[model samples]
Target: MQRLLDGIVKFRRDDFENHRDLFKSLKSEQKPHTLFITCSDSRVDPNLITKTLPGELFIIRNIANLVPPYRETPEYVSTTSAIEYAVLSLGVENIIVCGHSHCGGCAACLGPAERLNNMPHTKRWMELAIPVRDRILKEIAKDDIEARRWMMEQANVVEQLKHLMGYPYIYEKTISGQLMLSGWYYIIETGEVFIYDKNLGEFRLANG
Candidate 1:
């Protein structure tokens, strides 16, 4: 906590002061270009990874970077609400669903149910990814744990992208060519990012 507090002070005295004009401009309103949705992993920093400034990317971080299928209900839907606001209200031009290597949420989905028995809410939340999990299990070999994990992580990103299309506003914008959707797989060990190619049906390095 002290470390974070000290960093805050330093940011106020240095980074904030240096970028005062930009920060001042953002004080009144913000017009971010993208809605970056990614995992809640501590190591995955959306702003740091993308090198984006404040008010540049409206971010939504959640377990496994999962996007639940769009549904209409009286229930409070945090993630769905954010998506609506970003697309309809903020007019973000793009939505990036990024999933990273070694995601605990993905692992939990792949592992035995008892592993998450203690975490009821987490277990329930992961139920959203069961379709992805089921597909991977049926198609991928279970002998290689590493291969399964990697594939599951990448597939989860694609799955979320599909779920994003379930939202009416997102679908409308995408069909009209006003909004673009991207799926990204970030390898933590290599610091490499792979973008999903819908045409190729695979993930390829961004530079490649």
Candidate 2:
């Protein structure tokens, strides 16, 4: 808390001054290129990882970075509505569904023991992850726990991307080639990022 407080003071004194022009430009308008949907993990800073500027990436961080299947139940949730606006109104060209290694939410989908069922809302939030379980189970041979966990992390990203397509605006844009969807996994330990290749059905490192 003390460090964050001091950092804010320093930003006001020095850091904000360094990027004054950038902030000034952003004050007028914002035209971000992508809708970056990622997990609300303390260690995962999207801008820091991508080296993007203030007006570059329009981000949505949530528990597990989960995209719930498009629903028209007459009740509005901010997450779903935000996704609609980012696609239809903002005209974002790319949508990135990023998941990371060691995701607690993804792992919880595997069992009741790990999931804190007492936390009803948290469990409900993780219900978005249910589809990924079947994929991981099908892919992992020998019933290996370690193998299942790793595959589940990557599969969760792909599953969320699939759910993104359930949104009408996003689906139409993607079909017409006006929008592109990317599934990505970030390995925090190695500082490595892997983009899922739909063609090869595997994740590969971004090449230099």
TM-score of each: 0.98, 0.93
lDDT of 2 by residue, 127-163 (tens): 7787788777787874598788878888888888888
Off by over 4 Å in 1: none
For model 2 the local lDDT of residue 98 reads: 86
TM-score (C-alpha, index-matched) for candidate 1: 0.98
lDDT score at residue 178, model 2, on the 0-100 scale: 98
lDDT of 1 at 106: 97
lDDT per residue for candidate 1 within 1-208, as digits (tens), equals 9999999999999999999999999998999999999999999999988999999999999999999899998999889899999999999999999999999999999999999999999999999999989998988888988888999999999999999998988999999999999999999998899999999999999984
Model 1 CA RMSD to the hidden true structure, in angstroms:
0.9
**What is the Å distance of residue 63 in model 1 from its true position?**
0.3
